[model samples]
Target: MKHKYAESDGTTRHVWDVERIWKLAEDLEPFEIHIEEIRGLDSVTWFYNGDEPTVRSVSRHAGRILNADTSLPPILTEDFRVFDGMHRIARHLMEGTSRILVKKFSTNPEPDLIEKL
Candidate 1:
């Protein structure tokens, strides 16, 4: 997304920015997760494995979900690969909710790849 920032010259410049990310919380699109879809999907987070989410974290997020807090950012994915927010999704599944909220990133790039650079 592009955002306009005011310049000292009394002009504004539109540039690529995180406005899209900022919108995810409020503009969640229904993300369908079939039981089969969760199987063998890859995690983008460096420390994440396919293991079940911890009860503590899941419980905490369940509260947020229950409270209807849009502050809970949507899980990001691309091409059926989960890069973040796995815990939130797990909590939804545990609650027997078939659909979750998500924001899909088109780049679908590995963040760790930048650190290696």
Candidate 2:
């Protein structure tokens, strides 16, 4: 899977290989972090576009959020950007959970691709 981050200019995309990052984090012990402390939560658009989310898009995320397995921890980078599992975090938040497990990479991985749109 590929994870995308919008560049400061908004037209550029930084894409990371989620599988590669997950592999790097597999051996790291998981730790708990307050749900509010996750930077990804600050942006209301991680799972889908907040500005104009389509019905299909919303439905897709709703299913993922509902089916998200909380037992598995979310993966984050050293700077706290989510590498994967945003839906799991969303599920925990919606359930009013204060804290959740996460695996953090000590170092950030380079983007597999970057492109300007």
Candidate 3:
């Protein structure tokens, strides 16, 4: 099957094959409650700065992040967050990856990042 472009929003309503998508989600290994996307911008703004978003530098590329076999340390703690996959999860934020899937842990949340994807 071809990789499809999703809205990056949590609403996967328009999708035609629910079972297939669900299976794809399963292929992701352990599906967790990814709430970051639903929580929106202000919630994650502090986590994402400019140059330091994606932990990898321009020369490193996404390949490095994917290639690293080590376990990633948590970024979003009580004080800070990680962008870079190799470094802290808060180190890398170079577009395309801002919309992340997180396990929802809050009852109430804020608006989605209208300015971003």
Best by TM-score: 2
Model 2 regions lying over 4 Å from their true place: 1-12, 46-51
lDDT of 2 by residue, 1-117 (tens): 545544334787777788887777889899988888787687766444444677887888899999999999999878777878888988998999998889998877777778887
CA-lDDT, candidates in order = 0.44, 0.80, 0.31
Which pairs of residues clash in candidate 1, taking residues 3 or more apart in a chain or in different chains? none
Q: Pick the candidate with the highest lDDT.
A: 2
Error of 2 at 35 (Å): 0.9
Task: Please tell me which model should have the higher TM-score, number 1 or number 2.
Answer: 2
Off by over 4 Å in 1: 1-73, 110-117
lDDT, candidate 3, at 32: 34
Candidate 1 lDDT tens digits, 24-88? 42455545446335533343332233645678765665675565533354445445444344555
* TM-score against truth, every candidate: 0.39, 0.81, 0.23
Model 3's lDDT to the true fold? 0.31
Q: Which digits, one per residue and each the tens of the lDDT, describe model 3 over residues 52-93? A: 555545436445544543333222211222221222223324
Cα distance off (Å), candidate 3, residue 19: 42
Residue 33 CA error for candidate 1 (Å)?
Answer: 5.4
